[model samples]
Target: MESPDPSSSAPVLLNIGGKKYATTAETLTQREPGSMLAAMFSGRHTLPRHPTTGAVFVDRDGKHFRHILNWLRDGDIPVLSESEYQQLLREAEYYQLLGLADYITEKLSWKKGDGTLETELTRKDVIKCIQAQKTRFRGVNLSGLDLSKLDLSEVDFSYACIEKTNFSSANLHKAKFKLVEAACSSFEHANLHECELTGANLKEAVLDRANVQSANLQDACLTGCSFIETDLRSAHLQSANLMGADLNGANLEGANLKGAKLTGTNLQGANLQRAYLREVDLRETDLTGAKLGGANLLGTIR
Candidate 1:
């Protein structure tokens, strides 16, 4: 007959950190071709074995080794806490298990209360929730979703990720969007009266013709955003970043723009009558034909 294959040989006893384990050489080498276990049991290099028991000795903590063996055998892992996952990740990395490390990282991102999606939900799930009247979506991830033309008035979306989402023509009156990441989002023609959007990131967003009157946008990032003809009357924009933003023909009458950055901003033909511009810098802003009658220019630059 043919000589015995080294990889398919008899069970190999291992002494890992004072713990004993019995497994075949093929079990360790067949799964991960480039792993530490494969290199050690490839029969190319000699390994240190206990003289008394003749078992291979490995200098590593065996607390999570069983889990590693189970994963190598059949890719099965149990639910673990954040700390436990972190610890197991270290072990996986040490063993050069790239796939297991990635799995652990994904699981870590799925954990709750971490400013990410606690559970990944599809658009159907969101629509179902809305139909069920469950409007509270705090800390949820709605990124790249199309939620336009929905009557989401008085909904709560605080601390949520809404980047690249389309909220155009949605009825969002008196809604809460505090501390949301809405970069490059669209709210064109949406009804957002009296909405709470303090500390929000609306960078490069489009709000053309949207009814955002009396909405709070304090400390928000509105860089390079398009607000053409948008209704922002009496809205709060204190300390907001409006650099390179297009607010052409927008209504800003009686709005608070205190300490707001308007560098390279387009306010052409926009209404600013009776608006607060205290400590605002309008040096590089385009105000040609803009209405600024009775507006406050106290400590303003330009």
Candidate 2:
């Protein structure tokens, strides 16, 4: 009979903020190799153990430690409240678990979805809500809905999933669409003056002839979008992605394009007078017949 390994035979005991936990050393080191727990039990350093119980002492809140243990055991994290999730994220950062910290950060981006509308609403329900003056529609999933030609001005759509939704000829002036996932959506001929669209995903969306004047679209993903003849005067598009987008004959006078990615973008005959193009790489962009009079080309790569 072969002898068992001595390291695998001994179990590890932990004392975390007055709470005791019994686990194996293999469990700590096997899953998270770069974590503090793995380093402590890797037989290289001396651990600070309790004088009486001889268990390793970790000075941290033990409330969310169980979740960490469960995650180490079997890559699973249970549904946690906002507070609990925050606490777990802190613990994960302290323990140097990069993967867990990233996961928690992504979850935090959704803002917990508490008190936010997440259910699907029909067109009639939306119309009724609009009639009732319900402007808040944060975190709602309104994907694949036909809401064209409606006066939906000043509606809040932050963190909402509006993928493939149609809003042609709609009055969406001063509306809020912050951090929304609006891929493949349509806003043709829509009035979006002074709207907030920061960090929005508008990939492959159609915005032909849309009145997007004075709107904010910082850090927005506008890759492969159609903006032909659109009224984008004085729009804020800092750090926005316009890769492969068609901006043929678009009126972009005085628009901000600082730090924006314009790779493969078509700016044919577009009016870019007085526009800010600082730090933008337009080497692969098609700028045929585009007007650049008074446009800031500082730090712009051809």
Candidate 3:
């Protein structure tokens, strides 16, 4: 029960077996004279630092007090790498730390070209959102989340089950949703710039009026989805299913629609400039009012 740094302090409360204590953060061991470990609590071990080592309280190999300095600037939990940031992000999201999660997301959005956290971090954004229990979003499982006409910009949902969720009018800029199961979800009027949806299941989802700039929908299942008035500039939809989907008034400029299924899908009033449409199936798909400037429509039949 070592006291936290005076400069960085939080309310100190101790708890034993099913009991609460008025213990300070100073000396949690049994050897300390005024120690509170023996009264209500029975265990005495230090927090672990090294994976190979053990706990730190009672000589069990563990992390040192000096590591606490590493968490000097974290608002609640300090993170060192993207994986760590992602882990803490889940914790923060689960704990309903709205401001803190948003803060970390903003920090994560920094381009990795430099020494920023984003560069140092890998893509572990969307999966973290699946199990979030905080932020007034508790009890809202991905199996049935109705978020119609809501603003959910820059949120994290890494390993969640987003099946049959409705996300109309959400702002999902730079959001991470990789390796998730979002089958049959609706995302109309959403902004998903630079968002990650790799290997996601978006089957029968609706993405009308959404901006998917630089978004990654690779190997995703978007069967029967709608993309009316959507902007997919520089988006990657490689190996995705667009069967029976609608794309009226949508912009697919510089998008990779390669190996996608467009059977009976709509593309009216859409722009496909410089898009990669290799191995796309356009059988019975509507292409009316769609601009195909600089598009690679090679080896495809309407």
Where model 1 places Cα greater than 4 Å from the true spot, the runs are: 1-119, 132-134
> How many pairs of residues collide in model 1?
0
Error of 1 at 218 (Å): 0.3
Per-residue accuracy of model 2 over 1-302 as CA lDDT, tens digit each: 11113258466788899889988888787788999888888777777676787788789998888888887876546667778788899999999988677656654655445634343888888888887675877767788889999889999887677889999999999999987879999999999999999888999999999999999999899999999999999999998999999999999999999999999999999999999999999899998999999999999999
Assess candidate 1 and give its TM-score to the true structure.
0.62
Q: What's model 2's lDDT at 74?
A: 63
Question: Once model 2 is optimally superposed onto the true structure by TM-score, how far is the C-alpha of residue 72 displaced, in angstroms?
Answer: 28
Q: Residue 11, candidate 1: how far off, in angstroms? A: 71
Best by TM-score: 2
lDDT of 3 by residue, 1-302 (tens): 43344323333343222233233333222222222322222233333322432212322111221222122222223335666566666644543445445545653554133542211211132234434633222112345556555445556666455666777777667767765557778787777889988766687777877888899988777777778888899899987778888888888899998888788888888898899998887878888888888899888776
Q: Give me the overall lDDT of model 1.
A: 0.85
lDDT of 1 by residue, 1-302 (tens): 12123468587888878889988788887778788887777777777777787788787888888888887775546667788889999988998887677656655654554544533577777777776564877757788888899888888887677889999999999989976778999999999999999878899999999999999999888999999999999999999999999999999999999999999999999999999999998889999999989999999998
Error of 2 at 130 (Å): 0.8
Worst ten in a row by lDDT for model 3: 60-69
TM-score of each: 0.62, 0.65, 0.52
lDDT ranking of the models: 2, 1, 3
